[model samples]
Target: MTGCGRREPIVTIDGPAGAGKSSAARELARRLGFRLLDTGAMYRGLAWAVQQAGIPPEDGAPLRDLLERTTVELAGDRVLVNGRDVTAEIRTPAIGELTSVLTALDPVRDKLTPLQRALAAAGGVVLEGRDTGSVVCPDADVKFYLDADIETRARRRRGELAARGVDVGLDRVREEVLRRDRQDMARSLAPLVRPPGAVLVDSTSLGPEAVLRRLLEEVERVRCCTPP
Candidate 1:
């Protein structure tokens, strides 16, 4: 479905919130032996730092200041925010809400997009985000626009949390997931969307393993078609 049909296999996995982009992309990267770049977690870490620095979520000026002083990096499964290790903190629901506000700023996106591009350009990176396929890495060798039923996505998220000892009501998680998707699609800066010729994978019926397998298979096919 990718029009660019580039020989390089970048593998941009873009989707709305709770579409399993993070977990799936991480695992897919591991299975494919590629570097995992969790773009959303980067933003989440920024939002967390923005809040921690006594900056109001709506204060673009303070948020801008935070990103400048903060050193955000992705090293395997570890996330470093402001030269500190806070990988576990960014996953909280509160950080996600703040992340939505932080990334909406043109200043923030302006700052982060370049970093994302450089990382993806480095090669064999599995990048995940709302706009990865559409804007961040439009020429990605294999662009996958992952999708799933809203209900399924919602339930799966909650289940994942429960497995980690965090209990969230299914109904609440469901509604929150839908709301976030709407927000992602509506954001003016690099909103979530499928790029032209991007392959669409609806994972409502497929588990993570099956979905990852199918993606790797497609990647192999895409690779084979390329002239060495």
Candidate 2:
């Protein structure tokens, strides 16, 4: 919510993939009238660009070079890469896998983290990413670590792909989700972790609206406790 002359709250939603962080964050921002920052989409856009250029994910030097020349614009549900809209292109399962690998690299994180921080510098923003609470916005006014069981998470991801007209088997989606989870947790740079003081919400049996309601309650509680 806008604080007028006062400081607006910075909300960080960090979690594993497909745990409803993005959807909940979007709703949370809408209700609060704040900006929504989807950090994952930024990486996914870059992954699409790299893939389009036929660059190998393992090739750090070239990837970094491409990033330097690339202009990634994330605004209003659109992901623009070098002035071209790639919002739909970057949401595929293939780009997601590439994003997982590219995001783990120090060079990529080094380039993107500052951009994310700049976007949130003025506050009144809900940032959703693997390490947003732990690394990107450690001092955020309210932080939430949303999670669900692995099977539930995989199911959610599969449903999303199906809605996009991508016919993927449940077993394959589950295996891929597991693989990405392992990589995210094992990555040396900005690995996923529940930052201290972050509220944990399990959405295994809950819908997006329920999760948003719970998070809004947390925000109200934090606001009440803060000094005016």
Which candidate gets the maximum lDDT versus the true structure? 2
Q: Write the per-residue lDDT of candidate 1 for residues 1-228, one digit (tens) a residue.
A: 333443457888988766778878988888878888888888888887887887787646766777778878887888998678888888877787788777778877887889998888766778988888888888888889899988888887887677767788999898888878777889888887888768898898988888888888888887788776
Q: TM-score of each candidate?
A: 0.92, 0.94
RMSD of each: 2.3, 2.3
Q: After superposing candidate 2 on the true structure, give the runs of residues whose Cα lies further than 4 Å from its correct spot.
A: 1-6
* Residue pairs whose backbone atoms clash in candidate 2: none
* Model 2 TM-score on a 0 to 1 scale: 0.94
Name model 1 segments beyond 4 Å from true: 1-8
- Residue 150, candidate 1: how far off, in angstroms? 1.5
lDDT score at residue 16, model 1, on the 0-100 scale: 75
Residue-level lDDT of model 2, residues 44-79, one tens digit each, is: 988998998898887477887898999888868899
